[model samples]
Target: MSSDKPQNASESELPQAVPVRRRRWAPSLVWLIPVVAAVIGGWLAVHAVLSRGPTITISFQNAEGIEAGKTRIKYKDVEIGEVTSVKLSPNRQSILATAQLSKEAADYLAEDSRFWVVRPRISGGGVTGIGTMLSGAYIGMDVGKSAARKSEFTGLETPPIINADLPGHTFFLRADNLGSLNTGSPVYFRRVPVGQVVGYELDAKGGFVRVSVFISAPYDRFVTSNSRFWHASGVDVSLSADGLNVSTQSLAAIALGGIAFETPLADNAGIPLSDRNFILHDAREKALQNPDREMQPFRLRFHQSLRGLSVGAPVDFRGITIGEVTAIGVEYMPERKDFDMTVDIRTYPSRLDTLSRGSRISGKLSPQQLIGNGMRAQLRSGNLLTGQLYVALDFFRDAPPAKLIVRKGMPELPTIPGDLEELQRVLQRIVKKLDAIPFDNIGQQANDSLKSLQQTLDSVKALSDGLNKETVPQASKTLEQLQQTLEATRQTMKADSPLQQDVRSAAQEVKETARSFRALADYLDRHPEALVRGKEAQP
Candidate 1:
């Protein structure tokens, strides 16, 4: 029994057919971490496969500031993709760059998509992409409207001015020449900058430069069909009757050329619209001096030289400007056998009326009628200091009769001698009158009169000398005898002697006649017409 117990203990402790606890074939909690991790990895792999995006290739002339890993593609200033690779094209003429775009941006890639490198640039409008300097260069993209999907694009050399997101309208400007103007030039509204020039191309057939310009929303409405555009780049200086006019848009505009526009008066101007073409003038005067009515060309032939008269000289009607001299020519007149000056003038007939529009009544009075009514043209002085001459039209009731001559499809205006010529004619008449005076005959008559007067004076002096020498004693005796005779005559006249009475009566009659003559003289002085008709009796 002892031995059996020992063996049983040994067997129980060691080798007894011990029932093996059926090992619950369960995985450890630590092992479960790997399975869950593997399942998540598989799911992420499947999601990544489903979310892969399209790869697009872009061709560029030069890969100036592009790097594959560092450069990013942007749209509306937001990152949308990354550049994967940049390689030289097989032809070596261009560079082919590959970009990987996010799935969200895949739909935006279309046939018309445009891409350009964003870098710091100074354009006529102003400095652009300055912020890109610090951030390094990147690819700028503009989404296209085309519905067709595409994965290849031709890159642009410069940034685009027209885009869907941009809030502006593009218009065309036609200029004879682009002076100091370039792409990105500023467009001004009354000297205030409001737009920019995007591009320009020469029209070979039309012989004009067509510039594309963009104006923002509110300013765009100011562009009308009657709007005038002019170059506002440099300082405009003009010397006129008013004063010196010096004008400029801004300091920046002097360095970079600019365009300016102004609409006509509200009463006469038309409405504004987008995409309308406008003519760009070279100067402000040309733009502002828009004539409201049509002009007619006329010819004037003058006998005097056109030395001071030049193109742009004013044609005045009674001191009011009505036209301008456009051309001056010389011609030899066969009839007159002299060289005549032919002047071509452009006149706005509408200027004759207060309103620019002419009426039928005024239009009926032809230019021929005006010429018949003594309307004539003459040269006048405009500026005495500058010696500039202008044309003057006036009426001279006594002007020589003349007729109109049509030459080269133009009517010739009758011209008369200017005021300077009239003065010369009057001077010549004065000289002729002076020459007709009898100066030699008058001198001979004056000499004879002086000789006769001198002879009479000599005789009177001799008689005075004879009286002083010999007649002194005789004169004393004569005076004594006269005094005695006067005393006797006085006594005889006072008394009633017959001879004295007769003399006294004669003196009284003489006194009476003198009084009558004095009265008549006074009456005649008071009323000289009394000689023609006797004076009326007072009532």
Candidate 2:
């Protein structure tokens, strides 16, 4: 009994032999939760690793509205990437943004791809990105056509004036200066807006401004090889021989500045190739002028005053513009002992060729021969109100003989006095002749003569006074006596008066006696004649 108790106690304390049973093992609910979670987590990790796109770094001048994990990269308003991180570059001169793009955008990470930050902005192009004011700023991308892939890019400070996908043609213009032109300045074709200035920069030589302009489709076809471009920035007001001319593209152009291009009617409008360069003239007048080829420099020296005559004055031939005055100067002539106003002019002989039916002046007639034939340059008033003067060339039949001479490597054309100058000279000569007259001597002699005439007039006045005071009464009495005598004589002559009747009877008797006497005389004279003519008249 003691041994059994010890074994049982030992068995109970050590181990107990149990029968083996084969049963199915199942996982607990708690294990299921944890195992399912682990599977799902592994799946998500593999997906993230496999579907991830390329990471790119963009360097910007400023981070601006960019925020890591908040700012999105978008192409055509669709989100394509997100900014993963933002940090300063090693030089601290720019902000570096690391972006993670979707797998779909990986293939478009080209070398020339453009990126910019979109925000509310107003430029000459008008308001843009205005929705960003409420929706917040985002990265804008313009996919490039380059085949090479790139992981780094430089962000643009401003949105591009033109979109890469926009259908247009880009042209380059070289200008001496940028006159009030901005990036979004409008370009006009026949005063209609067809494009905008995309970009401008100084040329490599820094001699001119190179402007890049993009003309939209359809309108781009109008830009031909012979097209002329000029600034249409403000109102162009000019006065010419025709009249006052005022022109403007539009009110907007007058404010924001603009450019205008036109293909001349007479020119061949050949299509220009890609990346063609054009010259931007300062004014439309200059852009449309016929190109002067083979310019001949000539000088004209005038002895008259050169007032109102300025450089750039038109040099015309019989009302046709053939050249312009390039320079004006004064030179002292030792031989003439006077100063001569020198005008340097550039003339296009081709103008004459066109006018003379393709007969060139230099080929047909020498300048000397032309001058000998009385070709002369004379200053003429171009505008009476503006007092502007232009050089006029014409045949002067009465002009003094002259010759074409060369001095200082420039052909000198002889000049005749202008009409105004000749009139001034004539007046000056008349004034000299008037000055030569003895005016002082004439004044003295006239004074003496006036004194003698005054004395004679005084004597006549005294005689008239005497006649009125004394002699006039005596004369009146005598005239009255004479009138009385004439009245008596008139009464005696009337037949109605007795004395006059008796005189009339006496006169009648005297007349009868005289008639009798005349008859007797006549009879005696007849008898004498009869006696002299013999006895035939006796009866």
Candidate 3:
């Protein structure tokens, strides 16, 4: 009983001693974790919102030169934006490239801004953008000048040949054919490059091809209203009377072709205008030959064969080109009752101008007036080797009287005889002279002379035979007889003959008599006058 009481009292005393300081409800450290997390998350959200940039969607025919994460958009070769994603549009006909542009570049996006894939290209001008090969292709952007901003853009299929700010003038050139000239073909002035062909399009009327070209400053001032443009493609080899003429620009033009222009020496005095239309000629000669003038139509009747002549054959005046043949047709004239050729020719009055050129010709200088002044047309040989013919006009002061007639509103000019007709007339005269020759009588006389010559030859042959046979033998016998007579005479004169001995004795006697006569003369000389009796007495 004492132990139980002590245990109970001990329990009560211990519990009372703690005084049980009432446990107050307080917050735990676990609640602080959520609050700290909220503060950090709020700061991160604000930072992300502040750093975000404008998003732009670019449409392209195909997704080329673009990477979702790695591809960068460059302006002036500086990175200003990055491609974020590439997706197809709702129509699925094109690729939509969404890009994130830097805040500064956002203002640069405009309607006029151009974006194109920069790739390696080989053009008439030569290889360009070749760096794209090693670095891989990339998108090139040309910043627009417009103040208006736009986030979306459509990409270009090809890079522009001329930059809008290239500091030059853009002009149009119309041609019937594109030739070998392509974009980037050089535009040359006197073979020095000054510009390039940018682009081309077909006319809506299908009449011609229109090409766009750019001419840089300083050189642009050289192009005038009368400046002529022509295709300068490859080496122009012309075999002419002057000799073989070989002309070439750069080696690039030899392969890819090019365009060249020059202000004609005749038309260089005109003022130049900006952005004008110029005709594209097929060749340099064609461009040089072209005259800016009003064309007057005329007709010529050719009685001779129209060989070595074409529609575009030149019409010349004193070796100077004045027009060209436009058409050639053969029609029978019921009155003439023969096939007559109707040749249509267009004459340019500008060719006659020494200074200013006028289009409209007055009635005072009409075709009828010119024909009345002895102006005649004739065909002449242009090239001897080629046998090419061209129409020639000159004042034929000796030409017979003729008149100009109008038919179908076109002036019909009188044509004098061409060289071929003159040649034919000469041949006809020769034939007539040949016909007048007495060929049959000459043949008969020639036969008679041949017969007489044969008879004379036969007589000579008989004489030769008589000389060789009978005459030769008789002459030989006579010569032998004469030899015999000489031998007889020689024998008579021999040393052993009596006749020779008698002649020797007579010669000795004469010699002795001469000795005696000489001795007598010597004695007479000594005795003074021995011729008297004195010489005998002395003897």
TM-scores for all candidates: the values are 0.56, 0.68, 0.64
lDDT of 3 at 409: 89
**Candidate 3: tens digits of C-alpha lDDT, residues 1-539:** 98799889888777344455788899999999999999999999998777777888889999877778877788878888888999999999999999887877876787798888777887555577788778877777888779888888999988877766677787788899898888888899998999999888999998999988899987887888878899998888988799999998888788877899987665555454544888898888889875655778899998888888898899998867878999989989899899987789988876676333554344338777788889999988888889898999999888888888887888889998898779989999999999999999999999999999999999999999989999999999999999999999999999999999999999999999999999878877788665565655434
Write the residue-wise lDDT of candidate 2 on 323-420 in tens digits: 99999999998998999999999988887877787666667887888899999999999888998899998999889999989887899999998988
Candidate 1's C-alpha runs over 4 A off are 1-59, 85-96, 110-113, 123-126, 144-154, 161-163, 240-242, 267-275, 282-291, 298-346, 354-362, 371-403, 407-539
- For residue 341, what is the lDDT in candidate 3? 77
Off by over 4 Å in 2: 1-39, 57-64, 67-69, 84-98, 149-152, 205-207, 237-246, 265-275, 282-290, 301-311, 327-342, 357-362, 397-402, 407-409, 416-539
lDDT comparison, 1 vs 3, better candidate: 1
Compared to the true structure, candidate 2 yields what TM-score?
Answer: 0.68
Top-lDDT candidate index: 2
lDDT ranking of the models: 2, 1, 3
> For candidate 2, what is the total of clashing residue pairs?
0
Q: Could you say which candidate leads in TM-score?
A: 2
Error of 3 at 525 (Å): 49
lDDT of 2: 0.91
Of the two candidates 2 and 3, the one with more favorable TM-score, higher being better, is 2
What clash pairs does model 1 have? Answer: none
Candidates, ranked, TM-score: 2, 3, 1
